[model samples]
Target: MNNRLKSVISAAAIAVGLCFAPVQAADLPHVVILATGGTIAGTGATSTTTVGYTAAKLGVDKMIESVPELQKVAEVRGEQVAQIASESMTNEVWLKLAKRINQLLAQKDVDGIVVTHGTDTIEETAYFLDLVVKSKKPVVVVGSMRPSTAISADGPINLYNAVILAGSKEAVGKGVLVALNDQINAAREVTKSNTSTADTFRTPELGFLGYMQDNKAHFYRMSTRKNTADTEFDVSKLSSLPRVDIVYGYANMDRVAMDADIGAGAQGIVQAGVGDGSVAAQMMPAFRDARQKGVIVVRSSRVGNGIVARNGEANDDKEDFVVSDTLNAQKARILLMLALTKTHDTQAIQRMFYTY
Candidate 1:
């Protein structure tokens, strides 16, 4: 055919193809998966070997590629944020991750975010992001108990459900969510209950926020506490978070740990005390010393669930200490770190513990 006829035919074909194309990718929700190495990205020696595996073996790209069904739910993309196990998660990584999420969610095209984290500290990271993200766009943190290379590797399905949850409009403004084993949990309340099980993450007392079933997210309740955009925390300019340490309380526990943390320049201390957040008599002196030296003290329970009532076992009023309403020791530490950045007043920090 002549050049003119060939060009005309090509243009016509292009136009026809455009008209027949399914909805463009731009029409779909743009969900970014930030991979912060965990069991979800882990690999085992054999399919049946669930334990004794290596973590952070796979990258975000590989995880995303393994889940083909994710494309139908959202415009998926992945970024490898960190390749460290969640137990080794540091404040530096937390700050960097939070800043990145805030930046991504601020873009008009980015609808939500899915974070693949280790189950060990996924809840802590999720709660940290929930308080500091400053965006209503859904952020779902998902992980797996089994390695991605296991026989029944739960990572792929969990990752898929996370993307679905992140892209859902109903999930927005409900705070950070933990999606795993077909369950949806609020970051503020979820905890890792089992060491090695698919259904490890749980909200024992209040129950999970919802579930991921039928390839979609279902919500039964939302976090009433302040979170996400509602929180006043801003980690944009922060290079590092305050030094906060958790001291586990036990029978005949001494103040050595508390004193050590204080001596090491801990800006805040979380007492993972016994029932009702009680402080051991020996630890009380160190707590008082910490308070005298301008270190914030927070009373949090080691128990799996329940509130650490203020002024119940410990004299919060006399000691000028803060109580973690429903926050566990680790989560309380996270909040106290952030709270220290804004204020040193015990009452203000205590209010943060209650509200956030």
Candidate 2:
């Protein structure tokens, strides 16, 4: 055949291939459901048995099967990442989930990913994944207040909302989010506020980032900073991290707790300080001494809301501590622990606090 004739045949073949390739659904977006056992997968005898239930009873497939409405929003696929309560989740589980999210995001057919997690440590996992997974696609973490067997179970609806949020164009590149009780929250700011309430999870200071309504997700605000997907830190490069301790500050507090953590070989310490992030005077010398010995000290207030002030504290400033800006103490501890994996520089740590 002539060169021109050959080119015409090749173009025709390419056109045919393009036409036959799989297409995303207009009614349903392609979604990957990564199920790590939580309340959503738990089973109980009675409605009030929220805490005393047997967890991990329902696997990802069973959970999806129970909530068939998820099919209306996305083409869903399930992977059982772990079958344990959220309390049992560890750094290993976080690494495993991050790796899987990375793998799924690489696929052309996948539009988003949903993680079903236990409420106890859902925020920690969400925050961990938020800092690690590098994907522009929506990654949503969701859980339930009631078990599947309960009369007023909230899992099915929460799962459906998560699917809607995951598939929506608005959710892409907003970092990892937690969709619960019809509210959309950034993973970095969301926390489980109540043990048994349907409206348990919330982002206290910033409020809900968005919400799912009318089978669609509507965004009221946009996350301004770069997160897991856009940062220089590589998720796959991390292994096990050093031990970190969170010490709560209170009135007339003794320095024994701080010294205990230091003596226990804690590589990092998070002080859940009193109001406005102030530590008791007695604990100041111990904190300063810990910093002198090369331990990382981060200051976060025990109060549920507001930023920790960096100025006007003699011992706090002397320790070269990084202040938690509007993040609750527990969440701040998670961020500091993860940040320590990369660097110990106080400036870099403070920059991370501001950005994320």
Candidate 3:
């Protein structure tokens, strides 16, 4: 054939190939994994070395590459949001993360989100996102007690389950979720109950939201509390959150820590008190003084489980203090921080403690 004829035939063939090219896969949900440094991305000296490992050593891309089965679960992608231990999770990172998630969930193309966080503060981050993310799409926060390089590391499976849960229709409107040890836990109720175990995160009283059984998500219960799009929290415009501190109440407790926190410009304080969130008599003066200075006070417990009922042990009404209800000290701090952003009135903040 002549050169001109051959060129025309090649062009036609290329056009045919273009027409037959596979369209983008629409069956799988597009799930984004946002990695904040935790044990899920940690590295150990050997496969059997679970502890004494370096956390946040691996990046998000490395984690995504480690789990090949995730390809079948969703249209997966990753972003390294931060590289720090969860114990060191800062308010700045929390605001940044919540803002990013809200922005992503607002997009029509993004179907779900998975956050890889340190187990220490995984519940905190999850609850924080649960209250701030303004979408019904699934937002699962996952972490492994074992490092990725440990023997029988749980990161891969946990991550796989997280992606699966995030992409599931059943997970929508379930509030933020925590997926680990083949279980799905609501962000508000789940807490790390063990120090070195795969099944550490648990809902001590309320129970699991569901499980990742048969390689799929099976939900039996849903959180009744306000969350996600239901909350009025908007962190998109704020650069910082109010400083909230926690004080542990014990025998012969003093007011040094309380005074220091107040002096440090704390806007609110959560007292992780004994049995029923009792405040030490010695510390009451400081707490009252803090309240006088327009600082909000919340009564929470160190007992791990049970409600810190209003007026049960402490005269919350007379003290002009707020009760944390079922919220633990750390969580109370989180709610109080967000609450102070709106109103400083103890009555208003107390109402928030009940609602959120």
Q: Give the number of the best model, judged by lDDT.
A: 3
Q: State the lDDT of candidate 2 residue by residue for 1-356, as single tens digits.
A: 99999999999999999899755455468899999998889999887676688877899999899987777678998999999999998878888899989998999889999999988999889888888888889999999888888887889999999988888898988999999888888888888887778898887767889888888888898666668777656658667766788999887888888788889988888888878888677887888898888888888888788777776444445568788877777777777777888898888988888887
Off-target runs (Cα >4 Å) in candidate 1 are: 1-24
Q: What is each predicted model's overall lDDT from 0 to 1? A: 0.91, 0.84, 0.92
Clashing pairs in 1: none
lDDT of 1 by residue, 1-356 (tens): 89999999999999999999987777789999999999899998899888899999899999998999888889999999999889999999999999999999999999999999999999999999989998999999999999988987999999988998999998988999999999999999999998997888889879988888997788999889999999989989999988999999889889877888888989999989898898877778888988899999899888867888888998899999999998999999999999988999999998898899
Span of 10 residues, lowest total lDDT, candidate 1: 302-311
What is the per-residue lDDT of model 3 for residues 1-356, given as tens digits with 9 covering 90 to 100? 99999999999999999899764567789999999999999999999998899999999999999999898878999998899989999999999999999989999989999999999999999989988999999999999999998889999999999999999999999999999999999999899999999999899989999999877899999989999999988898999999999999899989899889989999998999999998877888898899899888899999999988888887989999999989988888998998888888899888888998
On the 0 to 100 scale, the lDDT of residue 40 in model 2 is: 89
lDDT of 3 at 119: 97
Candidate 1 lDDT score relative to the true structure:
0.91
Instruction: Give me the displacement of residue 350 in model 3, in angstroms.
Output: 0.8
Model 1 root mean square deviation, Cα atoms: 5.1
Please list all clashing residue pairs in model 3, or write none if there are none.
Answer: 47-151
Candidate 2, after superposition: displacement of residue 262 in Å?
A: 2.3
Compute each candidate's TM-score over C-alphas: 0.93, 0.89, 0.93
